[model samples]
Structure formats: C-alpha cells, structure tokens
Target: MAAGAPRIFVSHLSGVAVFDPAGDQVGRVRDLVVMLRMGQRPPRLLGLVVELATRRRIFLPMTRVTAIQSGQVITTGVLNVRRFEQRPTERLVFGELLDRRVTLTETGEEVTVLDLSVHQLPARREWEIDRVFVRKGRKGSAFRRAKGEALTVEWTAVTGFSLEEQGQGAESLLATFEQLRPADLANVLHHLSPKRRAEVAAALDDDRLADVLEELPEDDQIEILGKLKQERAADVLEAMDPDDAADLLGELPTDEQERLLSLMQPGDAADMRRLMSYEDRTAGGLMTTEPIVLRPDATVADALARVRNPDLSPALAAQVYVCRPPDETPTGKYLGTVHFQRLLREPPPTLVSSIVDSDLQPLDPDADLPAIAGFFATYDMVAAPVVDEAGSLLGAVTVDDVLDHMLPEDWRETEFHLDEEEVATDGS
Candidate 1:
C-alpha cells in the first residue's frame, strides 16, 4: 500500500481474509504484531499474524502486504511459512492489547482499549498505531459492546500502555532514535556506553544493524560483532555489503573467520573469500560484488528497472555494465559501460550494447587505491568496473567506498568548526 493509506482499526480487521497475488486464499489475519515504544511515541506495526487453513499461524511482515482494502488483505505471495513465534520485543494487538486498561493522560481517568487505528507514514513504508479508540468506563471484557463514552485520541493521550520503565535496557532508547539516519545513528552509538551500545546493536533488526554497522568505526564494528551469537553474527555479516563484510571479516582471527564463513550461504561466503584474497587497498578489495550487470541484448528498460532498486547505493545505480553472458559477478567477458544519462536519452526498447561506451577503460583488479582514485578523478566517474586478467567482470567500485578508504582513520572523530568572524568572512 502507498504511504498515507487510510487508518485501519484493529477491530475492523478482525478475521480479515488475506489473499495471494493471483487471488488464491492464504489465511486470515488473527492478530497484529507491534513493538511498543517509549512514553509518547506511537508503536510501530510490525506485521500480521495470519491463521492458515490448516490451523497454523504465520507472521506476515508489513513489507509483504501489498494492500489492505475492501476488507481483505493482498500479499506479494512470498512467505516464510514457518510458525509464528513472538520475540521478546514484539506484542500482539489482538492477544494482548485489546483488553488492556490504560489511563488518559489529560484527565487521570481510566479507559479501556476498544481498538487501535493504524496508518501508513507519508513517503515511508512504515505503519504505526497513531490513534487509540478507548472507552471511559470500568474495565470489563476486551470489547464490552459499547458501554461508556467512546472517543478516538492520539496514541500519546494514553499513559499506561507505553514502556513504564526506561533505564533497564535499550528498548526505550532505540524507540526514541528509531527514525535517525544511519550516519546520525552511528554517531549516537559512538557516544553510548559500551554496554548500552551492545544492547542497542542487539535490539536492531539484521538489515538495519548491517547499515548502521557499515557507518561505525572499525573498533565498534568488531566489538558489536564479537558480542552477538555466532549464527546471528553470520547472518548480519551476510546482510552487509560484500566489500564491507570482507573488511570486517579480515579483522578477525583466522579460526573465527573460518567459523563464520562456514555458517553463511555458500555463494555469499565465496564472494567474501574472493574479496579477502585481494590487498585491502586494491580495486578487488574495494569493489562490491553485487552490481547491475546485463547481457548485451538487454533493453534500456531492463537496465532502468535494475537501477531503480531502492537498496542500491546512488553510485552503483549511476551506471550499468553490459557483459557477454552469465549476468552475475564473474560475468562473461566485460563489454562496456552505459551511463544512466545515456539510458534516459534513448528509447526504452533500445539495446544497451548499441549505446554502450567502450572507449572508457575498466580498472584492473590489482589497481592500488591511489591508482583507482586517479582513474576516477581523470574520468570524472562515480563508479568504475573492475575486470580481471581473463576479461571477466568481477564487480564495480563506487566513489563512496574509495572515499571511505582514502580519508584519514581519525577523520570520523574529528570535529570541525569556525569562529563567528571566520564564518562571516567565508559566508559558511
């Protein structure tokens, strides 16, 4: 569903039927899984607990739900199919929240939660419980068939529901800073106590933790990874960019590295191994194994679609590489680069090979950092392909990765400021 979707009351969603893409019935929504935040912030709606025909319940993440309209839920048809097990950080709307009694912050009067209204945040995929439908009456059954004066109020208007205690762990802190960008969040983590830092790290989801870990200093990355369960640590590593993952893995003991590698997917582990084989300051080590690679016959439309993926960094999306065959990395003979600007200037049906720029030379895998930096500067390129001696395209290195390595080790810690007189002179 798009952002700004209409508010959906939990009571109205009771036993709502859920269907797959082709109109096949999958299950019915039994409960909504949410994680409560500190004090006044609304709780984040995680997903739905759906009950299958076979009496099995599975958790369907909100990301998978394509739409919730006309009293039915539509899914993208992809599911884990595993049984639903609520984590310590999760709460069920139907099972736990419906019948709860809370106090109205405005009047110190008791209220019973009748239902909750969830709405999607504008421009974001997140859904949150923004309003509480409560009744000002003595606590009775979860749904008391409309007893006293009922009204909808902001989520913050109620006080008994949020985390009553804040100092015990990072739950409150995490909730407070949930909306921060990765770089800002990294700064926050850097200033936290070691124990609290680990707590926050452990609380974050795998994907989020991966992004934040990439921004943190090497020492913090090592410390956080060291404290996690080995299996979880492996999963986090797999979620990280291949180049960054390899860099972090290179800092561990040989035995430790081998152990984690064994737990990762064979394909992912192989990529990490290949990257680690190169010198830390070489093109091969600095390049990410994942890139937009297509055969010569692929159309501009296909390349555009690949570049539109939200997960790709801007530098990686700035260009596409056309190869002979075997589209994945270690792709067939490297062909030519197609800038996104060129794609926009051509028709959608035009073949990428016809417009490819073969005049630009690719970087050798063994190119040193200084050589690679000079290549980018000389060409005014944001990204460049790394080809092996055999003419196979291994990966592409982005400008961001080059800057990360080129900057001084202590640059992240250094603070820069100017006096008022200097600022006035330079005009900021």
Candidate 2:
C-alpha cells in the first residue's frame, strides 16, 4: 500500500453512503467502475456508481472524489445526473472482478479472489487497483487444508481470468451469485450477454434458478428457460412456486407446455395444471397450492414447525389452514385458518382448531382480480385461502401476487424518480 494512501477493500465500500462537499447525502456506493488497460497494467479506477434514494444510478467520476474514509465517500459535489452506462472497455469491481479465480504467476496455484484493495495514487487525484485478497484452494473442498489467513498479493502478481472463459471463470462467477439475493442476482443476470446468462443459469441449482427466474422479467424468464434442457427446465419449474410456474408455462405453445409438464413430478404437474385451469386474472391463477395445511386436530407446535420452513414465503408462513383428512389440495374439507400471530400467543399444546378464524370466508377460485383485491383490503390478511364450490381448500393467494397483477404491465421496466429537476452541484 502507498504511504498514507486511503486504501479500502472494495467489499467495504459497498453500500457506503456518498456525501457532497456541502455535507449533504447524495447516495450510496453500489459498485466501483474501472477501465481495463492493455497488458499487465492494473485497471484504472473510473468512478463510483451511486444509487440515489429514488433508485437511480448515477456516475461520480474519480475527479469528483475528494476522500475515501469514515464509512462514507466524499465527493467534490460535481456529478453527472445521467444514468451510469458501462462502456465496452470498463468493468465493475463487485459484479465482474470480485470472487473470481486467478492463477498465481509464481507457484501456478489457483486461488479465489475474495476482495480487492484500491489506493489513491501518490501526487495524483486518481485511484487504481493495488492488491487482491485471495483464499487458497477451490471452493467447498473438505480435503483441502484451511489457510489461516488470506494472501494479499499485488494485482500484477496474479493472472486475471476473463469472464468469457467457459470453464473455471464461469463457475467462479456463478458461485459468487449464490451469495446474492435472488432479486439482486436477477439484475446481474439481466445485464449479462445471453450466452453468459445461459451459462450462469445452467450452473445454478434448480431451487436457486427458480427463485432467480421468478424475479426476472417474463421475456428473460422464457429466454433462459429455453436454453435449459427439457428435463432440467422441468425440474426448475417443479421447484418454483406453483402460480409462477404456471404463469411461465402459460407463455409457451400448448405442445411445448405439455412436453415440459409431462417431465415434472406428478404432484407438481397436478398443481400446475390446476393453476392453469383458471383465467390469468382469477384467484386460482394467483394462488399457490403449496400453502401450509394441517388437520384441525393438529397442535400449535405442528403449525409452528410448518411455518418455520425457510423455503416458505413470509406471506404463506403467516397463516396455516386447518382441514379434514388429506392435507394436500383439494384438501378433504375446508375448515378454518390459524394466524401465526395467534399461534405465538397460545401454548404449544393448544389445539389449532380451537382458535381458528372461522368467520374468515375463503375466496372462490373463480373470483376476479378486483374481488380478490377487495377481499385482501377488507380482511387485511397477507394471504387468503381459495376454495372450490364444494368447500375444498384449493390454495392460498398471497398479497404480493395480487399487487403484481395490480401494477402496470411494464412496471418492471419503469424507474421512479424523487423529483423532476436535477440538483446543481457546487463544484467545491
């Protein structure tokens, strides 16, 4: 590190607030932008990608950065209001560089890049890559000896691998995606080339791919799904929420849909078929068939265990349905629901049916969007059960699915702004 240089690990700078010279909060650092140069030269720092409160990403050039410490970034108050666009020659530290595997030039040993250290150049206002922190051995190997400390080597000492590498590089990138939230990973996937996106999707497990696909736009969802083998695509669909899986399958041709559906497990295929039977705007179409359903005789402890499942969404976990025999849909008979809140206040030994919300009427599968919306608004429930005419519990519609249907068709592509006018920078 340079003497007295304000060196910071790239990971540490993520989400740090950025402030203007007048001490006003501007935004938070989302990622660092760097320009790759020829040969072995360290990539030059280009700017900071800051995401404002409105979720608008703007660029703050290195010339505007004054200091880099105190858990926040200090800028000269000069910034371009235009959205940050990645140039062909530039790369993102967090999105592209971090968590990559590189070969040590000296020992030919491969290590995973954990973090990057950048420092301000002496006698210049520019920042450049200085060192990288790497962990020894490949990821998830039980036989590999633990390295007590991370090796910090100069950027020039390691051979940086390009993301275009179909083998190890792609694997390293996908491994890093595992650490991010599904929404965040979806955003990263959206920015990648179609080939790279397919590669990443192929590398992810069915559950993870399903979660990421759920967060993606419909077009992108179809594109990635098209790239997968029929069997693998069916597995991913099986892992997805029934409502979402049905929606995606609805976009395909009838023949294609049937082909994939036939490959899915019988139970999952049945749920998808049931969900697809209803109109897109109906309660049945928006509901998931996998809600926590228990017998009336079950204890509060049983309900709690089902709710505690990490795979269940918060809305689905918020309540449990009490039914007759056959806990699966179409459940034997619709009884009542036990809210998770009520379970917390009651003793574990207490019977769930004793505190069931009998007054809450289940929604009919044929109910329209407006009716479902009103039901949620009137009941103030996170989820409402959808029942058949024979009073069998079919599924539960979550509030999120309702809001998704209520939003504009292209709302996913729209960016909200805090104000119409751009603030003037003092250029201090």
Candidate 3:
C-alpha cells in the first residue's frame, strides 16, 4: 500500500451507512451529492448522501474519509442532513485525503491516526484502502502511552472491526500465552517485561499455570505463586502431577506451605505430602503414580482407549504394559507391551499376546536417578514403565523428570536452547 494513491470513487451506494463512534447505525447513503465548479470543469463530490425526514439529504466530503473496508467507509466529521444541505460550496480532491488526522473513538477510548497505505489487488487490478495505523491516546492528554506506563486493558480492549481497519499495535501477546508449551513458556518468560509477565500470568487459569510451573525455575515458581491468591495457588499445586506439586510446595515458606496444603483438595494434598516425604532428588520423589496398566486378559482395544484418555500426558510411550489381576502372585506372567504406533496397522481383534513386543526393557523402582536418565539418552525413550522387585507394575518415569536428574542444579538458570538441526536429526 502506498501513500498519495488516487482516491477510489465508490459507485454503488445502496448499502453504505453512516456509523457512529460506538458503531451504532445512524444513516444510510442515498445518493452522490456533487459540488459544481464555476467553469465547464467536471463537478466534484461535495459529499455522499444520507436521506433524513422532511425530504432532506445530508452530504459528507470525500476528503474526510479515513478508510474503507468491504462495503463501508469511515469518515472524519459527524453529519446532520439539514446542516449538510444548507452548507456553502467547497471544492475537495484526492490531494486533501492523504496524511489527514482522524480521532478514532472506540469503547470511549480515543485513538489517533499515524499513517495509512493503499493496496492494489492483482486479479481484479483494482485498488482498495488497505490499512490505517493508530495509537491509543493517553488519558486527559493528546499523547499516547509509552514504555514504563501502567496501562490497564480488559479482554475486549480492541474491537475486531477497528483492528481490521488499522493493522498496528493490535498484536495480542496475552492471547498467545495458552499456545506456549511448558518449556517454551520457561524460555520466553525472562525476556518479557514485568508488566507483560504479570499480564501473561494473570491470563492463565489455575490448570494452565500448573502446566507452566513444571518448566519454570523453582525461584520463578515461588515468585509467580506468591502473586496469586491462596486459593489460585493451591488449585495450581493440586492440579500439577504429585511429584511436581511436592517439589514446588517444598520451596514455599512454612506459613504459605501450610495454608496451601489446607486449601488443596484433601486427597490431592495427601498425595503431595506422600511424595514430599521422600528426598527431593530420589527415585520415589521423581516418579509419577499414573501409569497405563491393563489386565492380562484385556484386549489391545482396551489399552488403546486408556492411552487416549484426556488426562493422559502428551509424552509418547514406548510400550503398553499388560499386567495380571491383583489377586495373582506378582509374576511377569502377562504378555509384554505393544508399540503404541503399531496398533494403527494391526487389526483391532488381534489378541494382546500376539501384538506384545517381548523384547521391551523395564525400569526398576529403586534404580539410581542419574542411571534412569542415562537409559533414556541410550534408548531414546520419552518414558519407561517402572516395576517392583517382584515384577509388579508400579509407576512411570518421564523424560522431563529424567532431565531434572541429569542436568546440573544451575543448568536452567541461564537461557535454554538446542541446535535445531541436531534436534531434527535426533527426532528423526
């Protein structure tokens, strides 16, 4: 879009309407009211028409239009039909339309025009008003808000119609918060301003906050939780995996720790407490209680259904363990796991034993923390099923938890990045 482009004359006017600052319908354009020159030159448009009562037609100058989108055009000044009809003759042209200022009123807030550009469509070979750049006017002043300013905005701060017209300062940083995974949030948080951090934190509900906290530093976790009310903090902690909940709770002050535990659901609070009873770096503390377990007689269909559960974490599993009933003596009598992706090609009616991958490796519950992490690096697994001494199914250890053990305590204090090509190749 370029400045100083020719103003497009809209020939059709059966649907164009005059809209108020609040986007209320005021009047419709009835005709093109022209201003005549003294000589034999072409008659210029004084304004467009709005037919009112008493057979009056209102006119608005072509130069006053700020932008046009779709079927509607926005203009500078408010109009009254009788006033427009009685106005003295004035000549206007395309030159008067460029670089003019207009006050945009939306939701009682004023926005000032900065610049605009015109775009020509290739297929139609026709030009249309492209975009208007606007900056929000400051309170009680003509200036706009800048850095270090405390600007309070609600969810509906900007209207979609207004945003569509002006293509500047309309990016929603808050809207992108939910799109970030836990690791991405952790990486980006420090780069954000304090105000932006607060806005992002405030935007997340308890459940979302819990997911983000898993990737955040312990200090950052405490800081973010402190900003939240006791109820919100407790809810976030309760929603987290029991191991993660225990880790965060252990970092809080004694009074906050007590208060949060009391506020959490009793069952969830007890679970967190149980995990906290173990040393922070130990296997019992890091392992997840939730594991995909199936009875020996259970079909592959049953296991597939469980894996698709909404509560199931997003990390891919290497194998699905088929276990025996609780009454049986703990023996690895059940068939081994079937690769999750293999189910797609295999028939649904196939017995669990036929599909089970017998050569799968299992993790011991009492295995060293660092040793477990090494297994992941060696085998490239997202998680491995844990079994007790008697071959009884217990829990699972995820790659993220393994990384916690492998990386040094200070490793995450700095920025985190991985070689894109290396990651791509590793994933392949």
**Per-model RMSD to reference:** 6.3, 18.4, 20.7
- Write one digit per residue (lDDT tens) for candidate 3, span 37-61: 2212233344556654455665554
> What TM-score does model 1 achieve against the real structure?
0.78
Question: What TM-score would every model get versus the actual structure?
Answer: 0.78, 0.60, 0.51
| Top-TM-score structure, candidate number | 1
Q: Per-residue lDDT tens digits of candidate 2, residues 260-311?
A: 9888877789999989999998999999998999998999999998897656
Candidate order, lDDT descending: 1, 2, 3
lDDT of 1 by residue, 8-102 (tens): 89898889999999999999999999988876888889899999999899888887788999999999887655577776667899899986899
* Backbone steric clashes in candidate 2, count: 0
Give stretches of model 2 more than 4 Å off: 1-168, 416-428
Q: Give residue 52's lDDT in candidate 2 (0 to 100).
A: 91
Candidates in order have lDDT scores of 0.87, 0.82, 0.56
> What's model 3's TM-score?
0.51
Clash tally, candidates in order: 0, 0, 2
Candidate 3: where are CA atoms >4 Å away?
A: 1-172, 176-178, 193-196, 309-311, 314-316, 324-336, 341-345, 351-361, 377-380, 389-392, 413-428
After TM-score superposition, the amount by which residue 195's alpha carbon in candidate 2 deviates from its true location, in angstroms, is 1.7
User: For candidate 1, what is the lDDT?
Assistant: 0.87
Where's the lowest-lDDT run of ten residues in candidate 3? 162-171
